[model samples]
Target chain A: MRKTLTTIIALALVAGGVAACGNSDSGGDGKIVLGFSQVGAESGWRTANTKSIQDSAKEAGITLKFSDAQQKQENQIKAIRTFIQQKVDVIAFSPVVESGWDTVLKEAKAKKIPVILTDRAIDSKDTSLYKTFLGSDFVEEGRRSAQWLVKATEGSTDPVTIVELQGTTGSAPAIDRKEGFAEVIKADPKFQIIASQTGDFTRAKGKEVMQAFLKAHKDIDVLYAHNDDMALGAIQAIEEAGLKPGTDIKIISVDGVKDAFVAMTEGKINVVVECNPLLGPQLMDIVKKVVDGQETPQRIVTEEGVFTADQAAAALPNRKY
Target chain B: MITWTRHRLFWPVMLLVLLLLSNLFFTPDFFSIQMKQGHLYGSLIDILHFGAPLILVSLGMTLVIATGGIDLSVGAVVSISGALACWTISQQSDQGSLGVVVMAVALSLGVTALLGAWNGLLVAGAGIQPIIATLILMVAGRGVAQLITDGQIITVNSSPYKVIGGGYLATLPFSILLVAIVVAATALLTRRTALGLLLESVGGNAEASRLVGIRSRGLIAMTYIVAGLCAGVAGLMISSNVSSADGNNAGLWIELDAILAVVIGGTSLLGGRFSLTGTVIGALIIQTLSTTIYTIGVPPETTLVVKAIVVMIVCLAQSPSFRAKVFRRPGFAPPAARPGEPGPDAAPAGPADPTETKAEVPA
Candidate 1:
């Protein structure tokens, strides 16, 4: 008899706890409740991206529910389900990977909650699951880098020998950036890619691989790094090899991080193609529009700019990331 | 000749030489060292310089594995140590001041020592399994590092700090010199003292060591502390080389590499005999393999697959049982006796004997 009573009390307590958790103040006062799931703080760019979204939500007076998935797809799905349970007005997330998000999106769709993708997109055939996708075009960023390289070497008839430092193997940005650069550079017969290798998007690997490249090929004329961090690393390797970075080899890279801008001012990096991480204000605007039952574009591309060494000093003060 | 060939380091050393030589097929200057600006510049020098961090971490891992403990948290400790040092340097009024750099190094090493002590307490004092104990720090230490750097890459411009990793000492990279000093010091400390024997005893049989009045708990804890100090210095080298601390990416998966180096160096995970020389050779092989991939122009997508295959071949060569099975010729010797067993000359003991015989000393 005593055991049965204890069991009944324990069950009642669990039920009470569940009830308390379910009673969240989501849209209770007719205010917008936005659920945003972010990728983990893996790099400076990602940290800045998270901060932009948070700061923008406050400025827009939207009650934001933020969750960090820590680079896991399952955590993201769990966060979305909780948002659905709370009946949030809108849901948005940066998918860690490009696949395996269809089931969660379908669940959100079944509940009539509008979903938005940020920073990274998902791979799904059903377009009706999410309201819109907002991010940068990595391929365009790569093309811009190649175009800048071509223009910088316009009058010189000397064949350009380029050594490429790619990002992690099989990543979306690495694939797109390589494709876009190859597509543009193929037009010029003088532009030749002598060697290319993956730096895994880290400074140490970049420097190590660049050192090997220097030893293997002494006549390298150009270097194209997929990210600014790798470019900065390659600059160090180039300097250590007793060669001037910007002058001896015209260095071109993507992701206009603050360090890259600093390098440009120092004349170590020649050009940086911007991949803006500050998409918070725009993401908030989209969320407000979707919540108000307004039409949103299927894809929203953030506007980015290219900065050269001459423009770096003037742009350094305004750089956010 | 038989004795020389039977030495544990022979296979790993041969593999290292083979990997370095294979690079010659692609780059003819793979072995040439040029004097440029009073410093050595060559592919060989780059391998040693880049492989220094791995060597230091593997040296520490050797001792820990000898004591029957696995430190999965060394990678996290590496990230934390670098993050703390870079963050401290960034906060200073004069980031380039030698005094500030020294303080940052001391502070980072001190904190990592404390983390090591925490792991030690969990394993030695609480009697928790070593893998699970170190695993706790492995997961949380990254978060702690991210907090220290405020979830961003902390970049510092300190010439004094850079000297530790990138600068030249005696016309060689400072990182290579640092690894040499640490490896030599560890060799002397372990071989010239009774600490090694006691560690072997503890790992061979905890109860026997306890009965022998060896303070197994304290000894185990000290090995972890030493491993932490080694990893802390490696962290400084890595961050100083890059001039930045990336909480998420710095020293990521380095623990696995260190463990691989230790295993390849002839240290058993079961924890008995260990070799420092073999570990150094193993680290060089891994670094050389990485350089070879770039030099030979392996496709970026297949880089990992190539590395995996090379590692597998080296591991197979190191396995005596595999060799014994493959080469069943009359001239070929049988597999060496299991560790902690009597030599062929001695009277054979019972196979079920739990007590370990300290017949052979680790070279």
Candidate 2:
């Protein structure tokens, strides 16, 4: 493990070192240099988020000094410190974990470098530490998924036994999604979550847990998965159990990735709640506006699309992720 | 009379049986298998199927621990091998091609064997502490796996590859068959030949084995390579089952389970006197517990706690001191004095224990 730890640390150092060399104190062309700290490429969504930011910065002609934190809070802190040391015009980052950022954000604030929060939110109530926050409201994502379910299962007077394949337990998405789903379904007496368990946001655990759910409950009407990966896994388990996924058991999931769309088109998945990851253009716009001395909104919610099976066939070919 | 009770497998087998019996209360047909489309389906069958990967890894771990070494890198090797094989297959124009799948598996195993040798070299040749030595690969291996996978879950569509994990041959899960073949071959190589005895000797005393002209270095390295090969196969099964190689999540924390299986299988982490059957049973016990967690409706938060309690009971059952302390109370006889000092109850499973296994301590 020392080998990998050394490798990640060295990689971070080299990245920061090379960028630091490009400009000793000021960036080229006398343009605004936006220092961006990303939360590493841990998922397809994060990868897309990184790409969008990079592409948008280039298109906008801003000097983007980027640092990948490799999903560690310490690395993010280090990158933020480096940004402060370099005296970039504007500093922005997606905090890996919510807490432990007050001290660092305070430093950036004291230095008069405006910070922008992207993709995720931090727990600190002090909004003045950052100029603006732009991302999807995770609780809203959950509420949207459940609302779609309610509309789809409209007029269903019979009891709907929904087996929930939750994401990693206690994560923001998992907790918010559960709350949102419950908030919508609670009013309706027909829908009841008879069994729910964490799949840990992985396909293998999703399938294993779903298979057990299938065996334990024979009257499952819906499989509400916390993410697309788990829904896809549950589809396989349902198929292997000699049941049609979309027909016999409807699957509604979050994350409108291409795979989920393909599943939706195949009628294996019923609907998908989209979590917009393409925040680069918007983030770049916000950064440029913030730097232009314009008062931006404290929180900017990105517009997202909800896809049904009817829309999946038309959308699959152009799916960017 | 206590000879039977002193047998290495007495505690593990007893724990396994007790667990199985306890399941009968919740699942009436827990042990009964029904034919679903000419294939077995039941809690017992699921145990063997899902237990295949752990069985393979633990079988290798038993040998490594038998030589007084622990391979913490097995889980990482699993993720790496799975990532490599899946990546190679996904790159192929025809992922379903049998020839390409074979090459992918071979290449994956080849790389894993080298990783094993790296651990072995650090421990046996460089004379580093076994835990610290293997820890290097343990930490770095998964990162390398994620690197190979390019930080994305690589899903493949190959029937032959899927067969390794989910396919059935003659109404039995192919994975179970794979485990059986590997277990039988491993048991034969260790018990029928003198290799097992040689390993036991090296693990029992590295200094004494060296003084007796034994090549301890070669044997130690060989065990690690074997462990790597086993981990590679297990990796294939995991990725194949899901048709996806999730570098971050695949085989996460599996090394701990493998080590626990080895310990529970009557093999000391200090090394020597291993049992393949016992390891198989131990792996099944772990898998059954997981299945029980789901079937018996134990919350996910409390799942690990329940496992910890079960492990404690199993360890206590195996401990002669603990057993003696409890049994010595209330007019009951304690387990036979020690490994060599056998009594009649221990005689059932140890027809040749006194002769071949001198320092064998299941506890």
Candidate 3:
């Protein structure tokens, strides 16, 4: 009899664990509960982004429902459905990729829950789907890296042979950054892209690709990597090839990671363009503005800065991410 | 056709050397190496070092393909094993301890072996198609890795773990040593024993072998387990090299490369007649080509096309029909219609049957 009773209790606990818990909020407590479907803790930047949002939500006394999609669009859609069911006042998500969110966005709209796009944008043509987009312009980030390269090699009449290590192919940043960089460098006939390849935005690939570039090109003057990790990897490659990275190959990259800053201080990297991943406080502010019926712009751009060796030295200690 | 070219390693070795020589035109110092802080540091060294993972994966793949079975889950297993090792190491109070890292390696290998056993059960016991059985894990293993990592790129800074991939022993990459050990062990296990012949027999004709005395099921299961063990070690190498477990990208599309390496090594997909040396050379050939691409200034966007074209040429050169058609003399004949035959069409001969004339397609 006792064994049967114990078995029944165990069965009940397992059953309870499987079911989704419903929110008990009726909005009478004067707190706006926000449901956020994140694009998972993909990188250090993403982890910091999540932290900022959660911390900001707590500061504003808003009940935040957080869900990590682990970089899957399907998971994001499921999380959105759960948010709609919970009747949260606001929903925000950083999409894993553009497109394929029309159905879920329409359902959220039907439920009268405003959706926000943070960090990344969606491809839905219907402008009414998202309340606003708040993120860095990746194209502009690319242009900044190119602009720095052009200035650093301004007076030289000699051709600047460049090798580009792109991020994941077909990603928004990879495509837009290539475009923006190409647009800025096209006018200058001396800045020739000798080689360009996708490193898949990982350290090992970056290292491997950079090793190849070093072997292929004896006169490569500029190395433009898509992200800090790739640049860091190239630094190792360049060093192993017995060439000074900052001197022999002027390294320019995006994403102001802490390691990038260290690399700059070590004379391995020349320039780093920032694409700020920390958007929590601003995200929370917009949520409040939306709640108070204040006018919020259709798009908001984060304030970001470019870092050189001197700038990296000053900012490395204070940089949150 | 000459007997020399018929040897499996002939074309692959020639292609590798040709590719390496091509490097000299772009980078004059392609073959130069220098000692740096008691370690070998050069592009050639880097090829052997970075190529270690591919070498290991394709080594296991060669055996699997020899059994007439494919394991699509090797890439996924690589991710899972790396994730497990990194996760376990990170949880320890001392990440750099020899005992902890050893335990982590054991734990990761153990789990992946079980996964291999699971695949073996499906293919050998349940009689499921090997491709489909491995494909199930191929799709689901990444999710399992993501769960273990909590959807984060788990980075561990253990010095002992660092030694596995990045450290040097006797002025050579520690990774190269690991590769050598694994390759040597695999060669010895097969060549020095009866296992190699047994595998060939089973793969060459499973039903016939079963009718005889061979336990084909046990042998098939053993191959999958070995493949899992190989992928597990590769995972450790990759994660240790980067000091991180990236669930999504850890071993992405590596299975395709391994299969390619196995095919390039002169292993027929129809099974039987495996070559460990040929597979090693094939893996090196691939590594050299990739390294040469960067050194030769191939455009990044078209790199894949360039590689595909070169691989095609090498494969085409090895094709017997192509050789017979192109290399045939003006008076060439098909071995004089076999001396015992009364006429050209007296009876069905080797590969002369139209139905048996299927081109060997490597998957």
The model with the greatest TM-score is 1
DockQ (C-alpha based) per candidate is 0.66, 0.37, 0.38
RMSD of each: 4.9, 4.8, 6.4
TM-score of chain A of each: 0.86, 0.86, 0.89
Candidate 1 lDDT for residue A100: 84
* Among all candidates shown, the one with the greatest lDDT: 1
Question: Candidates 1 and 2: which is better by DockQ?
Answer: 1
**DockQ for model 1?**
0.66
* Alpha-carbon DockQ of candidate 2: 0.37
- In candidate 2, chain A reaches a TM of 0.86
Best-to-worst ranking by lDDT:
1, 2, 3
Q: What is the TM-score of each candidate against the true structure?
A: 0.91, 0.87, 0.79
Q: Rate the local accuracy (lDDT) of all candidates.
A: 0.87, 0.84, 0.83
Superposed model 2: Cα runs more than 4 Å off: A1-43, A57-115, A124-131, A288-294, B1-6, B21-29, B326-363
User: Model 3 chain B: which ten-residue window has the lowest total lDDT?
Assistant: B354-363
Poorest stretch of ten by lDDT in candidate 2 chain B = B347-356
